[model samples]
Target: MSASTPHRPVRADAERNVARILEAAKVVLAEDPTASLERIADEAGLARATVHRRFASRKALLEALVAQLNEQYLRALHEAKVDSAPPLIALHRVTELVMEIKFSHRLVMDVVTAGTPARWSYLSAEVRERAELLFARLHASGAITAAHPSWCLKIYLAILDEVHHLPAGAPELASCADEVTARTTLQVTTVLGALGGAPLPH
Candidate 1:
């Protein structure tokens, strides 16, 4: 930590190379689950040896990508400020954001949900606790009518799991970006309304 000590610098070329490899792997993996490491390296304009040096292996690359995505999700949750919003609105907004992420990265979400060994299955406990707290507030406020507050968690997971794996040709629902979101929202809203002590506002 002395001022006289030399500070080690990461070479700009190496930094760029790592960034390129991550970007290329994301694109290639979306299109082809079994995308070759060599092709990914070529796509990133790096040699196979360099890609290996950066990622070590395909599994390492995927795990890194998943970690990056988790960070993004955490940032989004923070920005949404769900805790400050009204309970029901907060729940809806959180669900909407989750759906948005799923739609944008359908392939990656699917791969992870399908028990991909390299990816983590759920968000960090802090995120989950925030969500559960929102649901508990909603339950207490009579925004939703669940005999047991834990039922909200069950419904939330069901919606997320179903929407994440929606088929390519599903029928469209109203007021949604696509058939998947629309139908999912409709089904989830209905269930929430039933469990929610009060009727949904028009």
Candidate 2:
């Protein structure tokens, strides 16, 4: 599950370096999923030995990346305020936050969700509950159908994935920034408009 909490004991400096490596890995690997750990070390401005000291092997590095991705995603889900906001409004905000995470951490997301029986889904309990409630709210508002409320929630996430179609061969990854936020919202709104009647007002 993408929302799994990580537990590891390390010195403060080593923890900071690990965090840096994971962040740099996101950008480097998003551009080239096959990028060498040497390249990641360069991006993080650290010695290759330093990265290897923290992560013994490429698989270990990737596992750390996935753990970091899960932490960031859980944070985003909590920050989305899905329960407190109005239905469509909440959905819009959630989509924006999610897209920001997805675009920035594209490679780690692919690693996590790559195979059959994907490791990623509505993994967080709070997120899943809030999503179902939001779907019910949207159904009541005629934004989604009356039947199969949970299915609607799944469809919402599926649509989000579909609309995030990255180009082939090492496209530059977008950061979780204001510009990317706006772009994701616009693109997703265009896609969801087809099903949910019209797009929500900007």
For candidate 2, write residues 1-202 as lDDT tens digits. 5344343334667889988998888888778878888999999999999998988887788777656666665676567665566666777776777777777666567764553264445255555666677667766777644445667656666666665664422233344445556556655464356446446755
What are the TM-scores, per candidate, against the unseen true structure?
0.75, 0.65
Model 1 lDDT tens row, 69-110 = 676666656665667877666666666676666666766564
Error of 1 at 153 (Å): 2.8
For candidate 1, give the lDDT: 0.67
Stretches of candidate 1 off by over 4 Å are 1-16, 116-120, 147-151, 167-172, 175-184, 197-202
Candidate 1 positional error at 56, Å: 1.8
Please report the candidate that would top TM-score against the real structure.
1
Residue clash pairs of candidate 1 = 144-196, 144-197, 145-195, 145-196, 145-197, 172-179
Query: Model 1: which ten-residue window has the lowest total lDDT?
Result: 112-121
Evaluate residue 91 in candidate 1 and report its C-alpha lDDT on the 0 to 100 scale: 62
**Collision count for each candidate, in order:** 6, 0
